[model samples]
Target: GSDGSPQWGTSAEDRDPPGGDRSNHTACPKQRTVHKCELLHVAIVCAGHNASRDVVTLVKSILFHRKNPLHFHFITDSVAHQILQTLFQSWMVPSVHVSFYNADDLKPEVSWIPNKHYSGIYGLMKLTLTKALPSNLSKVIVLDTDITFATDIAELWAVFGKFSEKQVIGLVENQSDWYLGNLWKNHKPWPALGRGFNTGVILLLLDRLRHLGWEQMWRLTAERELMNMLSTSLADQDIFNAVIKQDPSLVYRLPCFWNVQLSDHTRSEQCYTELSDLKVIHWNSPKKLRVKNKHVEFFRNLYLTFLEYDGNLLRRELFGCVRLTVTLPPTLQQALEELDEDDPCYDFRQQHLMQHRIHLFFLQYEFLALPNPTDVTLVAQLSMDRLQMLEAICKHWAGPISLALYMSDAEAQQFLRYAQASEVLSARRNVAYHIVYKEGQFYPINLLRNVALANTQTPYVFLTDIDFLPMYGLYDYLRNSIQQLELPQRKAALIVPAFETLHYRLTFPKSKAELLSMLDMGSLYTFRYHVWPKGHAPTDYAKWRTATVPYRVAWQPDFEPYVVVRRDCPKYDQRFVGFGWNKVSHIMELDAQEYELLVLPNAFMIHMPHAPSFDISKFRLSAGYRGCLQTLREEFHQDLSRRYGAAALKYLTAERSL
Candidate 1:
């Protein structure tokens, strides 16, 4: 029931139909319950020429794609309002939602002080913060529209929703906990800001906001931070984090992938397949994303020309093969059915909202909002008989621990030749391993695990390889060993014991599916380079393995996988041509996850197959190297010639002075 309303809840029996529901407050008609929802809502903050181009491309992206039906709302500067509005409506669409006004229209200005203050926002994209949020958010999907939504908005709203216990207010509750660990100011860093958050994409929870006096919160934060600092790294993002973190009751947190963008570490596309339930794709200034190389354009071109990809994988990527079906609410259900019969937006406000509200209830509060927090179903198929073989992967198993899963296959007869060389390390272990095949790929089962990890459920996982030998009582000894270091977060789980002269990372407690995915994606890159350089393992690894029995789990964890600030995800500069050396991204993810690379004095793990077959005799990292250089150059244009030239050079040659 709506507390401030004229009674909103009904005690009817579930109102939900068998596999679908028609009684939703905003349900559509039946003829077509499935249609692309591409209506666009944009907040244009800057009006300079380049900003204009960005908006133009943004507008065309929405306009040119006829398959995606859309509506546009342009929030422009007061001075240029007239010209912008004309250009905005010039583009054809099913509808044009134009609100050409000054940033002053956002917050009420009772006097002259307010009007002059409006000019302040114009200084640096303040319209994004000054604009009045929608009072009626019934049909709005706030978008930068700078991105191409190869998928639909309706698909997102259909599968996802907010936490509706208190009437889900917003669809996205950002994961900004990671970077907030340390705060930065005027080139100086603060130890903490509680948690860092990105306010890129928001699924407005209007009615709830109105009821809870939500506008007051945004207004306050803006006045305090946006109006004060005017120079925070997160910008509007910082103000948003202040509002939500302080008021838990006002908003519900959505899952990790809902508004996926760049973390200081992760990229949206790289983790796209992993974030299974992603709905709205916030192409957050994608034109500016720091990718591999100038070749990052190659990826952009590939995405735009997705339909033109070559071969099977390219074709699958461009014209995605994702099968989708969504059940709409009664009003939308009705509107959809009558579209052929010509239904107008005459009663859109009242009827459309009623239906939208009901369906929104299911999407936000139930399944889609979060990843399967506790495993539900795997992507692969299995008979009911095989289901029992799959374990629940208990939550406790996910606690602070690192695990490493790797797979490898030698030409059947080749194993016989290496047996003699593999005898140095003696401990044996058993864990699940899946075999994947490709013509000439070095299938180190664990290489994929090394790459795809985003944020682990548990802090610690292993970094040991398949051909590696483990010291006896390794787990018991790790307990006493880690108790000695002062890692950033005492909760950190880095157990890279230097035993038997080999060192490996204790990465995290992950899912079997995750390990499988790591394998799947790893094969895509691992065959290009060596997983581990042959002679890198320490010769004194055995003695260290014997020395760790008396240590305790030490060190602090700087990154918290449980509550991440989405911006911390590692991003790949696409210009990176190839060692495909970019595979090192996996280590970066762990670093972002708060694991440190500990050079051991005496610890080690056994690597039965310690050679990287991928770094072939004719290895030419130049193309891949140049690709990386170009990506950095493009992403940080000025930095390429100044700040990052040296770093970029080193990245390309895998040497400091390259």
Candidate 2:
């Protein structure tokens, strides 16, 4: 069978002799032929009680591209069988057969294959297929559930014909040699650079692997010391690398585009330029299933698009509860099973992603209703350095906005000139740009804030930084909430917290709600507000929402960056000229006036991703910071002394700005 001869010839006329010896391969009809193009056998492992939905999605993606005929044998657990059966039955085609084989049923054969690690045990399920699957399955293309086929899977099956006499498996090479780096210390024969592959995608010669003694490979995994030596972060990947290393001739490396993983993205930029030619995309990273962010959703949506579920009712019926469910292995599955949904440590980011996709589904039809877009004005103070962010901010928001840009020296003015000439300002007529020229590297931020405040004509003003993006329906909701408040409550300052995204890019394709889907809810924390009891602000929107009147602001400081206030509220203290202690001084003044600070429920601005602008060491030594401290003492000391006596001024320099 190792000889370069087709076990089942392509022609319908090819036949084996009647009652011929069938010991070498699985016994089939003695006079039967299989046209390779007409039928294909694809085996996918979804063991360790993983999600059935993802496997269904993978199958749908494969079926979308291939029209001829397909037989997909799924190796999974009993828990997933019912769902898989229900899903595949609905998607069944005339020439396709969807079959499931529980990995537990094959336990007797692989009993010698030690369950050293759960991941390694799960990986061994693929090896058991030769004994577990029907004997007629000689050549099977194995795939991980995380993969989606972009090209017809029949094309991938054809790669089997390209294999040499010695080649027992067909797989794309690993994008990098990072996986093989450990073999250097063991003095083992490592795969050549770019020859190692992620086991996410593989075309296995099941009959040959059986002939080559799959039981012996089982014994190799059972050895404790050897398993420890072979162990990597990815337990199974390391073992597979060693197997291929011992017998490199057994594998035939296909083109890189066949199994493109995240690591493969480092290939020439031309790979993306020629994306249409890509056959398969494997999201082999564990995070791909756990973290449901925009990047992960991008590929998932591509798979879903090809699935092409008809009508909104059908889409909701299928994916309503199934969205964000992942096919996790044993370790993660156990961990997730142990954690409650409401627990502080529990991860619900994926659920948020599902909500966003559902939101996008609704966003397709309904017109966004804004009560009065002209009544409220968004005021932002920014330095000229973040001009692109300013442009993006304006483009994202539909209503009128005011930008107070502090130009620090000639370079900033030059940037302004470039922005003026460019489409940044010209395309958006509702945006009002107010440039304040100053002569230093550190622009006068507090002065800029006051300038922006002075320029706003609206009765209600939302003061925020240039990078913060308001969530969808915020404008309409704010308008309705403001209208509901009593005359005295209307004068209150609406406090909204800012949540930061852990990204560096300034652009987003989706709305703020969609972007919020990417953030881990457990990791979401508010910015530090100095004047709060614990030096970090905590929002209690429940008190404000349920109370008859606006929630009273007694001691809480107003961090003005994401607060909406009446036009007549106290302005930002211009005396505190630089970054530190500027916004809090204004907040302290608002608190001094006893203006109510109502924390709006379920509404907040998202901070666009960006690195800190100032270097800490240099900023501490700068004249701006030095002058800021003196100005802070002079301005805050008087207010602190008058408001709560001279004793309160003790914290003036002792507790510096964060």
Candidate 3:
């Protein structure tokens, strides 16, 4: 064991052999035997808005150098989780699998340990690694989001095998003199061993750490150290070193090349003699690539190479066939079941957190070629049946369209073929299709809307349904109205009057004047005029007929008219899934936020008739479905009251009183 050979463990002989089911095979075979490559497990604690990009570049670097497959455990918040899931799903790298654990789940474990680091609680999440990861995972390589690998990750994974019997972690020594208390006179730092250890890159023997009761050990060390130090300035790193200071045998020292620290005060020269020997580059400073180091340019260039690398080239044959059905994990399913049925939005919240297999930005052939500054983007969601309408919408708008399409695997393949054959859909380059595969019987309409809205790249977004045909030149009219009216400076939504006609063969209206003519002729009626008059009554179509300019409209109950608003407006609530209240809930939220809804005199949208959706049909036929919808509606109003105060719900209260 002292000769540096791998020490599997004291009970290594009791474990099964490396190759599986060797009992049936002869001692030697004629052909060379191929052994399946073991998956390299890696964990990263990535939180905040800007961490997704850094983590993506880090993962790309690992995939570039490692020949074997990888399994990534991302301890992230909701924002980073959604972004990363969309990216990795679309990238479709054959050798990569990603699982996300909510950072909030581990907050209780480290919340007691006060941290002064900018990352705060997220930085301390690493201390709960033994509890955060699955129990089956015995070993994992944990890396900081600010690192890029220059060598195969397998070489780093191999370090775990070299850990001595008493060692539970493998890490590089800190390449700085801050711990020596010599930076300034009377400097005091958290207790640490000689030079301490850098946690930027770690080989965590999770099984061993769990056996050693890591949670209690770290807590005791932190509690004792906090008494004298007041608080930890370096988060998990400080506690890790403190624990090691008590027992040095708990850590195995990794080579300096594995973590070339690039902090402004780093003394890396003492650990490495040449740049060529560096296996990993760690920009451990807040300044990142801009940190002041002797070899800053070299390290910066290495990080940029991975940053600019083409992710498409790293694509390979998918690891497995597309799953026909996506079953919610037991944890998610139990969470959903335990939700208060009376809480209308609980399911919606769960759906947002649910790990559904999504492929984002699936096809965007002309996204990059479009002009940089577009005025408005059409954001909508649809199923495969709506594929035929894209050509017409794209040709009419002739601007940007961020679409979320829900379909099965078979339907997606069919739609791809359909897009290739149609000239309008194929030649146009400004549309982005984000595919959300089928999950359950109910369609996640609001989730689709959020996906489309989130991906819109324009300054303003025209939120509408895919079944509506915009009045000709609507895009230009809205763009000119926005500038002429100065809508951007104010909290406003430019409402486009919507109409519906039963006659499908009639020529679509091109101008507001012609639309009024049809209105007079009794061919087209205001959308849902008879069944759901309140839905569009707030737009005041009677006044819109004579008004020549944009007019402000008061927020009214059940108002869900289509509108053009800023890209950063409040998102649709995912709880109002199925039929009924999805769009109405969003309208209510906008009202609560005090957004002025202004009716545009020139622009309009006409609905094209189509068969009812499955959700709508269920709502009509099943009393249980209708009851659920009513319960959700009440809960949503209560939520709005709580979020924006009772003043925000005055309209609803007034309507009920009437």
Candidate 4:
């Protein structure tokens, strides 16, 4: 076989090309087995032992959901044949008949074919189906192993009737723009070929394919460098497209829901909603098959359930219903337990955010349940480098604690891994980590804050950052302050000044009294009293809240740290990106809305010392972000002009009531 000689293969009498045949349906021979009564005939080409389980699971999914009789034909290697034989016998599902052919038999005929532009050996195997399958089968559905039928095989079979006389194949068009655009660029003559079809699902008329001798067309593409010139790894797909361009009427386009590609999230405009009538879901991307995100995890777990299906009572129950409830294997169970809860909020928020078509992508973290019922959810955004800071904050903040940790896309997985390993943090399931922005992109502080706030379920939320460590008893003080403000009908914000350590020695102060020793005696700053009230705006650092007790003042847009507000309060304006004027802009918005900003006399946090230059210039905002900030500045000025008539800009400084 390896010597490149022609092998024995089937040949049909009808010798017309594909589109020229309209009356060859009855030319196919009749079947010799009882499977001829089945209404659905599905064929799959699996390569080796690696895809053996995938093929078995796909077959199980089809058999589990179909009410009509079905027959399956598999073209695979010897190892897979052994695996499927054992799998079918163990499942005890006998209404179906599976006929397997050794794919090696076709190799002698295609052995001389070079794999220069070959995607995979499986692609080579697909081209042999016309000769390997029974001549009696007139129509069949070919599917990729890495897919599941969400609906019924009968529905997919119904698409065959919709195919016109000249349409020999029914398929779903590839909704991806990248592939279509590249195809257009390379093959400029066929700009009107339309979006090419994905070969994942196909309704084929085997008789027509054989009558037209279409296998030669596929072989010709490989021999003539038609696909090689295009530099496409999709060997079979390229050949199919080459033929489709010659005869556009040879394909019947099906709805995209029939072959929903999961990683095509970027092509959301072409994707179907969850509520749509989906018949098949193709896990086309190999990256997702490795289990990187929740969407992949969702499909992976379902695939596992299908693989281990034993036709037991639970399997029978799942056969009637699409859902299943079964205990996971011990090793997989432990692995998943180390992750966060499978929160549906990730899916819901993804759909919500993508509607805006913002460049931002959502990351999924496993969620831990709230440690204990508390009135507030403490939230912050940080990277993996700040684990020590987070641990220290968690040790000092003593209250019913629930946290939402937001990180960029690059470090979210690493930080989550660390959190899962930490005994002190993972001891309770309360923190939710969100990947709110792309890896290494300009950190959209306002957008992260809004995501954290929207996900917070508590009545009050304490918004702060990672580097700031709360002083002892700060949480208790805030909890008490919130109770006192409950009776007031007006919205309020509890503000606390943040102090930074002069050096690393003072960074880990042994006690609250030791840290408090640095605060000035007469409400004035000293060398040790490093009260940095700077939050993207100039602050009167010499002044202090000398009321000697908690008191309310007219709100000012200056403080950014240790602010506790009701959950119903307006959220931060997300348009302001980078470092300058973010939290202060929110404060100004609240001031204009007449919400009181309360100053707590004794409450403060010790900011951890880091590298030099913790200023606005340190964060170089991208050009896009600078543009966004400019737009916000204009909006703020326009609002001011509307309120105070041109001189309102001067009143920005005059309005500080504290």
Candidate 5:
């Protein structure tokens, strides 16, 4: 039926045999039944964890036994409990992956303190071979997940007869010095079978791994300090070497074509051209293809291409609970049951809440956490809140908010200089104070009001950018205005001092639609972040850049939102932590159906300007960058690459209009 080959396609279903259900993402092949998948199933055990998840997933799906290609699994102790198991029942996990096993379960024959680490891992590897390996498996190859097959594994199996029948095996020779031992004759070897080998690519025989002295040899060797296991006493591999050298009849030294060891990959991001000629590609420490943001982004896109239920599953994992089932050994199960359900947790809720929110966007600053409220400073929100009526219309958008403070650090000499240079703010009688500094804040409207409720003692403290200028002197005008009201009784957070700006960004056309758009009639600001193009003022790098930000006038609510505080008020809730300040916006959540906005008439202000430069491509919505990816999308779950480096996008949505 087919005229071409799907050389690059990795879908297990596409390759599954005839009469098998190929409808589901899971392919059930009726052909190739002679091999039975359960037999060809291979598991790779790794002591290192830089790469495993996604790579293994692709290999498993592609090489999975439709008629039984092989069900490949990777074992490691590094997986976190909440990562894959907690998110989905779909079974396939994200990242370079393999089936998991904890090295902590391996027990030592002699009673010495057993670690849950490297030494413990050898025991687990032995246990896996002793317990699960199928009896009929001609030779079970335990390889590193970094392995990429140059050719189909059938070729590797074809050569099995080349070596005498055996269960455990490894690549025979090494061209490099073993990190564990020196190969030169100057070094003495007591039990080592021969020179040490690179542990990266191993072809394991379950029976040979379960040989008479394997566990004993590993235990005696691992008992001493790990450093002592050099040439004189090799760890797991050393034991294998000793055993193999004594009995080459049990193990065969395969040629370089079988297991190729790579020297360095850090210099480049890729190297498969030379590798294409290999049968089983073994990645020793896979640095280039390790799982990270790219891996997450790949899976994120797959949801749209492959699964119809993508978003639903994401929401469920984020907001709901997942069920997990594990088959533990009888003794292990009993030990876990003895402990109370909550005994291991000191305060699970608190830790979970904090850890979960760390990934949310609004958590990277101190202002968002409301660290201090008593450090009294004027709080001003540079946002659109004109008439009280318009202010009420803009309260519905739930977006992020950011806060910043402007503190003028002036010396006693500068205070004297400022009095003559700018008369807008001057020394008051009996206010004998040397200029330590004058301070202020720019908060989102929600936080501005919150800070005001706590800072009532500062009689003259109010919200206004330095742009708040008036003929009567900006500070005097505000101080006089606050004195006229009963501060405690009315409790107005801030006396409104919104000023009109003199500068804005002129819009240029990138496209016809946005180019024709104009600033609304009588509205202020076209571009944002611009400094006073004409002022020689106190300059901070932060202050200097505040000018020249792009701004546009659009439909926004306006309300008389001012700064108010009682000096003892708590810090503001910092849910908003980036930009955008909508006035009287926080109060709308309360029932401020209609509150009149008091405008400072005939006044003007210019927001500090900063130029805009952005590159949107940096935030690609790939699997590794999107929301969490624990399991593969069931729809495209079948399309895993042999190397599983990239997700293949399968669906394209045409423009609804075009």
Candidate 6:
């Protein structure tokens, strides 16, 4: 190839076999001992709504072609983290390990760099990799979410052997003339060496970059460029190009076919002569797949192939008996036994949280097909003890239910056996079970709720607890009401009146009229009517007794009614764990977001009496637990005010005055 760069594409005979050793040609002394079986470290920055889907496709493409083990480091927001955690946990791919780092934690490092790109601050997260990742990691390959691979990634990893001592990064030349200032009149791009480099696929020598003080270098380059330009239009790419323009020897130019850019204005014809020669497809345009390229269909179909690939085939069991497990070291096990039993806050202490990892969707069972698609799904959470209630709930609801079950590693194994033997629980095709496990005493109540809510596929969801039994025909009633009430267009939450009974063995009510009779006879009462009147007072049971149509209810403090809301409503705040203020904080956010709460005329849910949760028992017995709950409540209100503004806090003030 010209310019001393490797050829864009090579025949099978010219390249090493898949996972073949190439340490003899290595240039960096630190990577000389690298073996073919070593885990390939890959970093990605994913945030926002659709990023998870794209990232899944990207990962699928890599898994399809790669032969070695993989370790993925995701820098993501809370939403993407939950979604991805649910997916990769259930995926159960052999030799794959995933780790998530909060994107908010890395924002401050690159927040000051103003970006004009559509991704905004998220596009600049790559700059923080040298500091965000652990110091022990020596090298990594960073990829953009909008990419698909057609060849084994080991070939790209092998490129590290070609890097000179002075070269700390490997990248392909930009396929467009955007950096040449030729796309439009008066165009001024950040400095570059000739055509500049595309960052979509990069080989990062982390140890080398750290030794060279990569952070300070890029910051200085960005500061110098900002003096002339208003802001960077390409985020990290612009700053990286400026730095490389100053020091040309710091980068090793990779084959252009590795990044065949499909942007609207891409000039990739000079990179590869045919679509078959391209190794990686990069849909860099905002209108991905729809971009104006002659070879768009070829790349689009490749991406679709991975997107729709059956993930079941990738499970570890398909190959052998390689099940995932969570085992603590002997030293950590001994340390946990020495914890003080008298400490009231021991369960939620920093030591416990630090030692345990919360595994989301540790085990999952999803229905591949259903006779009739459901309009509304019941989203609920429970522990292993409540697993028996699922059969009754599924029998009565007669619709889809997305359940998040919290359990230990042993309980998860027990659940699998229990589901197989129970006909109603296992044969019902509309129920999806997502199992979560964490080695801690306190329950992550809101975390479970958010996981269930995020995984729901229906247009609307009925948010409730596993202990509550819905009134018969509630699913059909809501399906009909959703059309007549125009619920699809309105920003509303249809409240379902709830009641509680102390008798463990009593006939469940079949209609609202039966429930009203039970209320009058004192066999049933509004849930927590006397103990916590403020909780359900906003529903106005007096008006609901004879009302035939939905009625609007004013927002009030401590109101937490089970309601059927659109699936895309605000997520529950995860900070409110261990029972107190969890559901109320979510209701308050719905109120703050201006969602109208309309009491449904027919729907009803009855809370069956059961043993109180561990968190509830602790709250009642421990003063320390109550104090922590109070502190969290105050912090939640303050955060709500900052998010939705002062006008949103007026509801709290109005409720207090009353």
lDDT of 4 by residue, 403-483 (tens): 334343234435656766887766644454444424223355666677667666667778777777777777777777677
TM-score of each: 0.35, 0.39, 0.55, 0.43, 0.36, 0.52
Find the 10 residues in a row with the least total lDDT in model 4. Answer: 355-364
Tell me the tens digit of each residue's lDDT in model 2 across 1-658. Answer: 1134454543433434457656776563342323434568888777432335456557657766664467789877654564455434433234556778877887665445444444555566766777778877789888888778887786677667666778887877776446546545654423333446667778888888788885576346435325455443444455566677667888788777788775333332233446666678776665554433334455666755643432111222111122222233566556556766664312221121111010000000121245243256788877655777766666556666766765522443355356558675556555655545443344466666766676556667788788777766676656666677642344577766566555555344244344345433433334442223332243553353344443544444333435777777787765454446667677666655656767666566666656566633445677754554654456566777687765455445444552
Model number with the top TM-score: 3
Worst 10 residues of 3 by lDDT: 28-37
Q: Which pairs of residues clash in candidate 6, taking residues 3 or more apart in a chain or in different chains?
A: none
Better of 3 and 6 by lDDT: 3
lDDT for each of the candidates?
0.34, 0.57, 0.80, 0.58, 0.33, 0.80
TM-score: which is higher, 2 or 6? 6
* Candidate 1 local Cα displacement, residue 388, angstroms: 71
- Cα error, residue 227 of model 6, in Å, equals 0.5
RMSD of 1: 25.3
Tens digits of per-residue lDDT, candidate 3, 1-658, equal 2233343332435233577556755673222211225577899998754576577678879888775667899999876776677777645567678899999999999898889988789989999999999998998999999999998787777666556689999999999887877889888888788888989999999999999999999999999999999888888999999999999999999989999998878888666788878899898887786777777788888997887565555655423344222344678688777877576545545554544445555553344445434389999999987787898788678778999898764566577768778888878767887777666557789989998999877889999999898987888888899888887678898899999988877688777888899999999999999788999998999999999988899987788999999999998987777788899889888988998889988788988888888778878998877777777777777888888986766855855775
Model 2: lDDT of residue 629? 63
Candidate 4: where is the Cα deviation over 4 Å? Answer: 1-374, 398-410, 439-441, 505-513, 520-547, 554-561, 612-631, 640-658
* lDDT (Cα, tens digit) per residue for candidate 6, span 1-658: 2224443322234445457756765562222222335578999999854676578779878988766678899999886787687667655577788999999999989898889998899999998899999899988999999999998787787678667779998999998888998888999999999989999998999999999999999999898999988799998899889999999999999989889888878788678887667888888987887887777778888987886565444443213223333334667667667666666545554333333223343333343343233389999999987887888898789888888887654565478679868988768756766656554457888878887898777888999999999988999998887777888878999999999998898699888888899899999999998688889999999999999999999888889999888899999976666868889889999998889999999889888888888888888898988886766677777888889998677765855676
> Between which residue pairs do clashes occur in model 3?
366-429
Q: Is candidate 2 or candidate 4 better by lDDT?
A: 4
Model 2 spans > 4 angstroms off: 1-37, 48-50, 107-120, 182-195, 221-232, 263-273, 289-301, 307-658
**Alpha carbon lDDT of residue 542, candidate 2?**
31
Candidate No. with top lDDT? 3
TM-score of 4: 0.43
